[model samples]
Target: MKLQVNIQILQLSFLALLFFTPLLHKTISSAPFAAVLHLLSANLRLSLSCTICTFISIFYYFYTRPSQVYMLNYTCYKPPPHRKCSYQVAENFVSRNAQFTEKTLDFMRNIYLKSGLGDETYGPAFIFEEDGVPTLNYAMQEAEEGIFSSIDALLLKTLIDPQSIDIVIVTSGSFSPTPSLSSLILNHYILKPDVKTYNLSGMGCSSGVISMDFAAEILRSSRKIQNVLVVVTESITLNWYSGDNRPMLVTNCIFRVGCAAALITNDPSHRRVAKMELVDSLRTHDGADDGAYRAAFQEEDEKGINGISLTKDLIRVAGMSLRKHIKILAPRVLPLSQIVHYAYSVVSAKFWGDESKPIVPDFKTAFEHICIHTGGRAVIENVARVLKLDDEVIEPARMTLNRFGNTSSSLVFYELAYFEAKKRAKMGDRMWMLAFGTGFKVGSLVWKWLQNSSQEFDNPWNDCIQNYPLKT
Candidate 1:
């Protein structure tokens, strides 16, 4: 009996050991899972803490954030004097009298005649008379003073607080030192010494767009930037070359005293009165060639004759530069709809084996308005032909050139203002601005109108439009 009892106990012990052996092995093998459970518990505590911290951060952001000032509205300041000038009859003065070579004069006359200049449909307007005379420094100074007064008047009329302007950008092509135009404006406007200021000199007709691009960059970087004031003008009085060079003589006839000030704000809240919002800008330079630079440079030859000569190749250079500009910009501002149309044209041209076939992208579908630089009549006509724009679409540019006579960098703005005065621009209208300069540079800016723009009764084109004798 003692042996049997011992045997039973031993059997039971063996069975108990057998049952616990598997559980022990599982626990040992899954030590990582046990550790994971501990880690999960710790992470849960951390997650709860993080949630509380996030809630507190959000609360702080809402309660203590700084008040933001959004641009509520903006307008181009047109002082009464400028308004009067716009309405007044422009004087026909021949400041110089160097006779153009008969051949050159005839060539110019033919170009002028071929241009829509004689079309009565555009009506009688101001035409600058070229005299073979040199422009003087005093004349430029006088022009500058007039511009300063005009800017002051416009600023006052616009009712923008002088103190609120954070930056000032001034551009001119003439010798702009010894009293930089920017200093003159700061003093006139009583801007604070701390205000950010920049004076751009030597950039010819393209300076206006260049200045705009620079301002946009500054605005994008600093949230504190509220208002940017851009002043564009040319001093034809100073750079008048008295030489017999036909190119220099051309300036004697074409350029006039003109100044324009534009106020731009990045604050989205001020979209109402703002005529247009800048969309895209492009600049291209072909500085690799000396010929491109010489195409528009001033030369001081013997006989004290100093003036810039126009090269016959300038038009070709401008065309090349513009082609380069379009290549880079077409991808950005061209709407997907326009892009699709262009793509279809490309594919069609490729399959048809007609590489010479031109694919004129439908710009009308993309832009409601176009403002090509008013460099000259021929330049305008060339661009119009390339773009396949109607004469009426280019009317504003032509009229601006007829009246203002290529006011340099500010020409585009003048054209834009003309459109506004005509009441032609409706809300949601898109405008494209193209300009070329001495750097053999071509640049463009795209804008969309925010509201209805109407022509002012006192606009320069008012009388001309009424008498415009042309029909489509």
Candidate 2:
């Protein structure tokens, strides 16, 4: 009986082993495939998360980046439809007649006559009719009327609805506060009451770029803002000083009645005329220096003549100030190619101790054209040397100075018009505008042309192109 029971147990054990062996083999065979499937699932989840994060990062960058607006079109105020009349200057005007002594006349002749005002032999010429009253007040009135009319003509031609403009920037050197020129422009144009407006006064020749800088900042901040209208004019009539001082007499020779109105739009959607896309701007003030302030200042020495003494140091101060500004600004607008070349030159100069050969920055790589302030011949010459620029690069400035004298704040625009009229600017060309003002300030504005600008009917360059390559 015991032997039979043991035999039954052994038989049951054998049957169990046979049934479980195949199951163990199958489990071992599938383990590697299961491990691979689990690893793939984890990797897929990580990849999806990374993709979503990358999309969010890209979207954030786009939303926060500042959008650059190309200047769609711009129009300058045309003088008038009337034919050009012969304008003359009276030698003996009201305030100046009593003050014109032999010494004063000699000084005036030296300053105005020799400095290139038509011919002294032809006598002093003013821009008014002979019968017209020669008072500063009268001149101001005429200038105001002419500017308003020109602006009206421009507005009519542009056909831009007054209500659509987002901002109006007005700049003038002579008058401020009482009857602000900006208010006069806004009221005459019948713009909206709440429309944003800025009146920049006391800035002198640099005001135009200052106004442009302000307008650019506004556009940079707000997406809703589009159109910006800038008016730049100099009221020489109001500030005429009849003093016997040489500085006071300097103004009589150079300044003339001139006004320019430009319409700049931030709307990229509109594409009709040449575009000036703003790239970079810089401003430097050396007001703390007494020499700079005295270089261009108004001094009254008990004589009623309010003379603005333009010291010989003015050009030097301007050059120094410009160098300072460029040091701060070059890294911003200059391309990496230029920066690399400039750096190599500097390192070579330093390590090699090559004091004889100075490294000058190659501005040609940065700008195709340059418009230096048309202040005077000396100023233009000095700037050209400092930047190592050629005469062709500064021709617009020289020509504008010769034709229009010093239009102050609007000088750069006139230079730009000259470039356009000559068809010197090509698509994708870059321009640099440099200006100096009363606060002993130097400012720069950089722009890139969006398209070629053909000669427009109203362009000032049209009339002067024939005479140009002028005797300057």
Candidate 3:
């Protein structure tokens, strides 16, 4: 329908232009404009007015159309072998630490065993140090390593010059240094002097998708903003919980160090080489609900040591928020048949008010690949339940959590890497990224693949991709 309308408008525009151009010639509209008007019939003047309106309308329609945003390429930071923290190494570290009590040790051990994190999850410098200090230097070092490594590999893969980046956005859940990660990039790379930079913090795991949404809008905001460089990383060295608070200790058991860098562009010339095109993005904030806001909050314990308290109500809050989120999102992306069925089911349930089974729109019908945030085992299962997803649909997310643990904002990107490593994503596949963060924030990004993906040089799962889909 839309294509037919555009074709008709274009034909009308061409005819209008052909007819209107001759009226402006000196022969018709020179100093003898009144004489020319006297020579013209009323029908001719009316035709001229109608033709001019058609031309102006067509011009405005094309002028206001939005530019398409594409992800040219992206790379995830692959930590060195020495950084891999085995289950044994983690157990020994916590057991030997003097700050932990017997109770705390047991709690952490239990959580670690059940957290779905594999032995190879990466850790920052602080964990391997003899003295085990979460110093500002070590935190900064971790951030620099992941950020620089990701950007270096991304630039190499995209074959795009650093100077071509028009905007840079850096996001971390809890770490924000004085110079800021964006400025750090500016100092390291000789980028364009007028490049715009933005640093965002405290948004937790959903930051990557949110930042991508922001970058897409930036690309659409102006034609001069051709490309955006987005770097998402987490400096977990300092955020590692030292206190014995059981809820806080979950961080120590599951969180890991990682980063991802992506180059997004609105330049039409790069579309052929781009990996995916942005289809739609959605974000929801549940901060108004106190239970949601404090579900995962950072606070100092009785001992005055800072740590993020992963409250017991977190899973519940997330599930409730997801239901509300999909209610709004389903209509935009679900197939027409699914939409109709879902609408009827919803109306039937409300009208009957019985204890019938709850209905959920089959998101699998809309997305061919899903990068569900690897927040934790429970978080993944909750999302699976809410979306009515099968285990196969969430394999990447499960494998990512086992391999990389919770890398905060970059978790979904790691899942994306997993899809590439598995060689499952093909050109034209519809991809979905769903992420949840502190403040009970939920974000979803829908994408259409521009080309098939192959193993990347910086793919974190390169050596171990074959070992995935481990026994459930």
Candidate 4:
């Protein structure tokens, strides 16, 4: 706000000086007659008035500069006790309890084995018994526990009073309780009664980045709204599929339990300790196209069992969406030399009819670290290929997938945890996080590290960072 005021003052001062320049010149160049003396005095008075006004404006702006937005810190939820479902255990449980026939079970087993998931991945709700009743109780428990635990920890770590949080935004793609997730948070935390709240549902995996984008805009818009608590999670309990639909079964193999809580504030004082500063963000949706819209859709099976369908066309649609998104983002982050080279490649290919593909700009030049969504092994592979990322550049996403098995909306946070656990992020380093979702949406968040972050004890990967960059 103060920055805007300063610019306006500078503009007005320049215009005033221009208008007075001619009068001052006339006073100096003209003969010192009676009329000339009066005119000179008048010009002097106007000049003094303009100078005083400009000084006052400058002083006011300096004294009243508004706070800058900062991402104070964030915490990703680790699976609760007894929730860590190993691959073999998950497979055995599925074999014994799933409603699908033997052939369909074999298909799911094959997908799981080759899904790039490690033994440590987690699931909040699994029905090990044959006649288990599907319940929202477990889903609610996961949401409540995931949200409260992580948020409580973040507030404690940051020493931020819950009552001071001005806004609460919760994004849970699969489950939204009746009181609303935001309301539940407010009630549980006993936050200020007038705290602004919002709940976003059905936004899919990209919703984590989307929620951050939303918070950034909100902080940019209002100085009074200092702090926002954003919770990104997915409910896996109710989403479990019992049907044999191949598309639906794909979700069962990948989606898992996870949640992340972040405190974003416009309080400039927190900048010193903040993990990263949001540099820029971009979002693109290809849902307008039929193929993209249906790439990942929720539908009932032949027997009317509801489940999310991960269609074969998902990867192609993701590539296309990301292509469009990065076209807009590249100019903002890429170095001028890389941008120029990329532009030259495009022009040469267009005019010279060069059959070779136009160059993909070196994103490594823009970001020191990258976190691609761990939607699945295929999603990570496609993003890496599309961006021409190296093996090391793509390790966080791959390893996060191996360890967490696509925690849906919270997956990127887990990948980010990997970077922190490995101590790879340095001060001033730029990081890029990209995610794809069922809206066939793609979201990118660029962050500049504020400090050289050390590994936090609560980081999900704390116990296993040394074993990562696994030989796949």
Q: Write the per-residue lDDT of candidate 1 for residues 1-472, one digit (tens) a residue.
A: 3356455555554554555545554554578677564444545544554555455545544343332222222222222332222211211222123343556555444444443333221111112223323334455454465467556655665578888888889888665766777887788779978888899887889888888877777775565647888888777656654455556666644555566777778766666666677766678888677878877777775666767666778887777677667767776777788777777777778898766654666677768888888888878887777677788788888877765567787778778777766678888888888888886777787887777876653344555555332453
List, residue by residue over 126-206, the lDDT tens digit for candidate 2.
Answer: 334454334656655645764686566566657778887778888886556466777777777798887788888878788
Cα deviation at 336, candidate 2, in Å, is 3.0
Candidate 3: stretches off by over 4 Å: 1-58
For lDDT, the strongest prediction is 3
Q: Candidate 1 clash total?
A: 13
What is the per-residue lDDT of model 4 for residues 1-472, given as tens digits with 9 covering 90 to 100?
4458778777766776676666666656675674656555655757775786677667756555544568899998987657777877777777777477998888988998889998888877545445555588877887888898899879878999998999999998778889998988998889998899989888899999999999998987675748999999888888888898998998888887899999999877789989889988889988889999999998898999999999989889999999999999999999999999999999989999988888999999999999998988888899889999988898889899989898889889999989999999999999999988888899999999999977886888878889988875
What candidate 2 gets wrong by more than 4 Å, as runs, is 1-46, 77-98, 113-136, 271-274, 345-352
TM-score of each: 0.73, 0.82, 0.90, 0.90
Per-residue lDDT of candidate 3, residues 315-383 (tens digit) = 999999989888889888999999999878877777888567557989989999999989999999999
242: Cα error in model 1, Å = 1.5
Worst 10 residues of 1 by lDDT: 119-128
Off by more than 4 A, model 1 = 1-137, 302-304, 344-352, 456-465, 468-472
**Better-scoring candidate (lDDT), 1 or 3:** 3
- Report lDDT per candidate: 0.64, 0.68, 0.89, 0.86
Candidate 4 residue pairs that clash: none
